[model samples]
Target: MRALFLSEPPFHFGVHEPAPDLPSRIQALVDAGDREEAVVLFQREAVGLPDAMIAQFRATDAFAGVVPLAQSTVYDATLARELSTPTDAMLAVDVPVTILCGQQTFPFLSAAAERLAAAMPHAELIISPESIGHRLDAHAATRILAARLA
Candidate 1:
């Protein structure tokens, strides 16, 4: 009730748009039964991300659990069409909001955070220097939020 934190939300809010072929290309990989590859492609195309961060993710214990998660995840034209929200809707949010995006995240995502922060009367935008691409720097975010909400 007091505050809100949105970490790398996919909503564009009309700030920017992703490449035209991005969704179809990723979906093609998925339809070919390569959801893992689709995930990688999305990361790469969405933000020009290097493989290092994804390699780190794959090395984690959580990677094994994501196979099913990835299989169930759908990224197609329909989902893409629904990702953006109106700026007026964002402006109508009455609570103080903190929108967090990685400095290395997708251009549209960073732009969305900036746009939301500007539109919302009490919103603050935080670009996490420690994050890579769209992944939040949980430690840094925790520290900042703790201090902020204290």
Candidate 2:
């Protein structure tokens, strides 16, 4: 069976200009054992999101669930570091891999997807036209995956 990979690793994109201090600030909060505060800070100070969007996310149950896993972001950062060096063994998996990126996402993310697809023999990269920045249109993505799986 084939595997699908969605979203670029955190390190794949350079920091966006609006929130240059985000990573360090979140790290500081985590280091101080304030995981919830870290989550709050992340939502409040995310690089590209406007204030209204952040408020909308804050009101959602999904965001509530995400709050507890805030510390995992640190782990994600670590994983990104590890994945930075994509060795032959890492790319040698024989299964088909689909790497999807948003068309309007940060340029680095699209570039990372291209790099990954080029490195892996069985991987294909798709830039979704229906996507907005890093936010993909879920219905469009679902339909595409369903067609592929079918």
For residues 1-150, could you state the per-residue lDDT of candidate 1 as single tens digits? Answer: 788888876665544455767777766877788877777666555544568977876787766666555433345333544666655665787887888888887666777778777777888898889986667887999987997799
lDDT of each: 0.70, 0.68
Model 2: runs farther than 4 Å from truth? 9-26, 31-69
Candidate 2 per-residue lDDT over residues 5-28, each given as its tens digit: 656533343334224455677788
Worst 10 residues of 2 by lDDT: 9-18
* Runs of candidate 1 exceeding 4 Å displacement: 15-31, 44-68, 72-80
Taking all chains together, each candidate's TM-score versus the true structure is: 0.67, 0.63
Error of 2 at 116 (Å): 0.5
